[model samples]
Target: MSGAPEDLAERPVHGVRGEPFRRLLTTWTATSVADGVRAAALPLYAAVSTRDPVSVSAVAAAEVVPWLLIALPAGALVDRMRCRGTLVAAHSFRAVVTLLLVWFVHSGQTGTFVLLGCAFLLSSAETFADSATQSLLVSAAGERELERANGRFVGAETIGVEIAGPLAAAGLFAWRPELCFAVTALAFGFAAVWILRVSPEVEPVRAAERRSMAGEIRQGAVFVLSSPGLRAVVGTVGLVALLTSAVNAIAVLFVLESLGLAPSTVPTLLVCTAAGTLVASRTTAGLSTRFGGAPVMTGALLVLAGGVAALELVRLPGAAWGAYFLMGFGAGTWNVLSSANRQRLTPGPMMGRVTSAYRVFAWGLMPLGAAAAGPLAEVTSPATVIVVAALSIAVVAGFCAPVLRRSLP
Candidate 1:
């Protein structure tokens, strides 16, 4: 079968140059803020509902498990549909879901099950939205400009999702729990409207040459497996996700119980992480261009490990802030480079499925790591689990550094 239209090739495409990217960027910023608020609110609500570490972690696990279940199918569907329309629909669905959560919270009917169900539904929608957005990004910003584009995207995400969103959610949650969901619903609706303003460019696989859904899914997976650099990227991402998921699962508990801080302090600490990420996003492209991809990637991982380890050893709040900031910087560097690298490696037609397949292998471990964290923290202490996770991350970074240095671009 023929590839996507020449317009959809790796070269800069018409119609998506100026306005579309701005609209997409605006949509992404809105969605990121909403997602950040929800991310903070859900775990905080769970912790307030019940102090059981297992139960609390379960809520975090629910947010990401959909990636394991539906990411591949979602990616395939995105490839078959108009990305702009898909984004619109996904954002609309998320808005409705957030509204439902608002109603549930207002009615005082929320439980762990309800929280889990809502988190899962939201994430399921996100699976499609994220794939569509990434596909759209490729069209908007061609391969030659991917690093710069991704850096901007990552910077906005860090600011909205990690910094501004979380800070607002914490204040809202503290004042009135339902307010958090209400703001999130509004953000999603705003995003849906703004995304509609993006150019209605269609880049789906041609109907005449379209393969079966299963075939398409396998094709994307196969493409990723066939490339050594992609293989290394996926492996490293998976390991990093696994370890980081554990830390995220228990982060609230660690802040509240371990550090003996107020719930409000959670977002304050996250801001530190976001600060680091913002710096990394701005610098990752330049660093990679100068030093090479492998060293930057490996060094980022080491930095993350150091941050995680510091969190366990230090007992002071200032120390925790610094550690989280370091972790965010490391994570930010890895995320921006990896995303740009993946987009550069994959063909335009296969972008959706390949991105989804990449996530299925890498992010699919998030739930497992989150679930395991609860039990481990229950048996041991949260600090112990975090330290162990940090060590594992270090080990992976050390082991993969040489291999990636040799393999990656």
Candidate 2:
């Protein structure tokens, strides 16, 4: 107990300074190229190339489906492989795929189904790289530094996700969309070189004992389902993610029709949310240390609930500003608390599997949320749908309050 505080103080921040950190950043940037550009550009490109929402959504779903299907197995593979090799190979393959995509686009021969199929393949490789990258850091840095490592990783990845290729994609699409894919391909190649240079501190995976993949998958599923503490955390986060993804789908409708906001205001308003998330990621450590993850998470969810509820009352004048501000703050803090909670409870070796499992739930339901938003909005309007979402947040937060207040040793 006496040594605990000192141990915490010595934590190393991943992707923060040090020569090796550059490699991590470069590795991170690889994913960012595809990430920032994918949501808008991919779907929009699909529409222009072929007006098929079914095909476009399939592309989006294909990208996400791999994460749900392969992430756990990828995590297990990470535990058994050389991390650097996995990352290097993953990026190298990504580069190849992106280049092939670019060539197809340049030839004006890109098809809706072809793009969707390729998205699945690229997303599959990414699953392997992502798990290994996550597992390698804590394995190298020791358990104590997991928070700092993750914090930096989260912040850097967030920034890249927020910025990176979106700006370029927008520019290059106007000039030439094909060039944009080529640029993305180059980014992946740069990442591959960076990862190849760094050495990974590999960990042994003797527990597997060469077990069947299906058996191992069942073991992971059982572990996640059986833990009440973890379930609460994942369930709460999943709820938030699902709801927010839904909110995102209807945000333009809310801003334009309900709140009567102008087009120019959209960027400024969206930036506020991004700013809040960045601030939250930076400050998560302090909050988690003070209140512990569970309490902070509970409060974050409650705050998010209040924010959502406030959306119900957002009228003209100062009310609109305040409601949106609260929403940004709540959403931002939720990510901080959820990430901290996951890192705190999970052991280093199991971090990959647990994180994958957590994501399986948290991210898995996002499509459902997006799908639900349309019908709900059609039936009850965007504002009412969000209010219903707010109530769900409130109910879940109330249920978790007791667990949240209990301190971890």
Candidate 3:
């Protein structure tokens, strides 16, 4: 497919170079660097500046908990506001938060408990920016281009969030903790400027009576529930989310206890996963375009099942890392198609709510899996968790296989 038909509203995603996609990639990379700093700096800040684990944990949770708590209202706000403006404002806020941390750290006021108050404020801004930028992608790419657009965004984020970003943090943290945060502040400032340049072409909505917050929330939830395609994809992603969360929490314990490996080995195993992730991203374009998103999703789910199953019976250290990489491959595959499919199936105005609803569905069960793992491990052994998780993926894939095969992109 050289290009989509000229008459079509959205261009065909033959390759990954829509203007918005390019800029989005650039913005994500910069922001990812900032994230990398924060990821490393958080613990370092506690270790050096203060020794209270509770405060450190609270700060960490503060960064993520708001995603679940405020996602819906944030989505509605995205629907009402200019997405680019919202994103730019969000980034500017992130810069301010980091700068405030810098001031406190420099002033020797970086009390562990005190910092968390700042973190909570920061998380609120993140909630706004993340929801808005996601919504903006819908307009910039249009419907036909969603999969490719989202794939590109995810690929960039993977590098920024998963790869180079962390590496940069590790390097910077060796020097000074305050320096790491300062760098974060700088990244967000640049990102905010870049975001200001993006203006998504929002599609119009028809006149409807204003509703209460509860009604708005229900409207968003009902919209997602009513869409069969969205429901199926959301269901599959949600299942994967639970298993992934468990495995992530357990992989460390597995290596430490089951394999008799030191904690130092964990990053090497995780780093190896980039191979699988990169391979998955490279192939997604061809697979999604030729076979359609459903086929790609099914194949990816099967790979996920196989990889998770492999974790149950590994005997060698090399094989352990190999399994991690393969699992990462499956993770890459599932995320690529599923995220793209979500964007493709949803309209622009609903992107915030839909994305939030999808996030809630996928992540809501994570605590259950994370919490149950330790108890389950004590009883049935760590391998049991791996086995059951693998089996779950296999069963879900089996049920979804037929439905997926019948539906093309």
Best by lDDT: 1
TM-score of each: 0.83, 0.87, 0.91
List model 2 lDDT by residue over 222-281, tens digit each.
Answer: 666667767777777787779878887887778777777887777666655555566666
Candidate 1 overall Cα lDDT vs. reference? 0.87
Where does candidate 1 stray beyond 4 Å?
1-17, 43-61, 101-117, 173-176, 200-202, 247-267, 312-317, 371-391
Clashing pairs in 3: none
For model 1, residues 182-248, the per-residue Cα lDDT tens digits are: 9999999999888876763658888997899999999999998888888989998998998999999
Model 3 spans > 4 angstroms off: 1-15, 203-210, 405-409
Order of candidate numbers by lDDT, starting with the best? 1, 3, 2
Model 3 agreement with the true structure over 257-310: per-residue lDDT tens digits: 877878888888878677678778777867888887777788887787777777
What are the candidates' C-alpha RMSDs? 5.3, 4.8, 4.0
Best-to-worst ranking by TM-score: 3, 2, 1
**Global lDDT of model 3:** 0.75
| Ten-residue region with minimum lDDT total, candidate 1 | 9-18
Best of the candidates, TM-score:
3
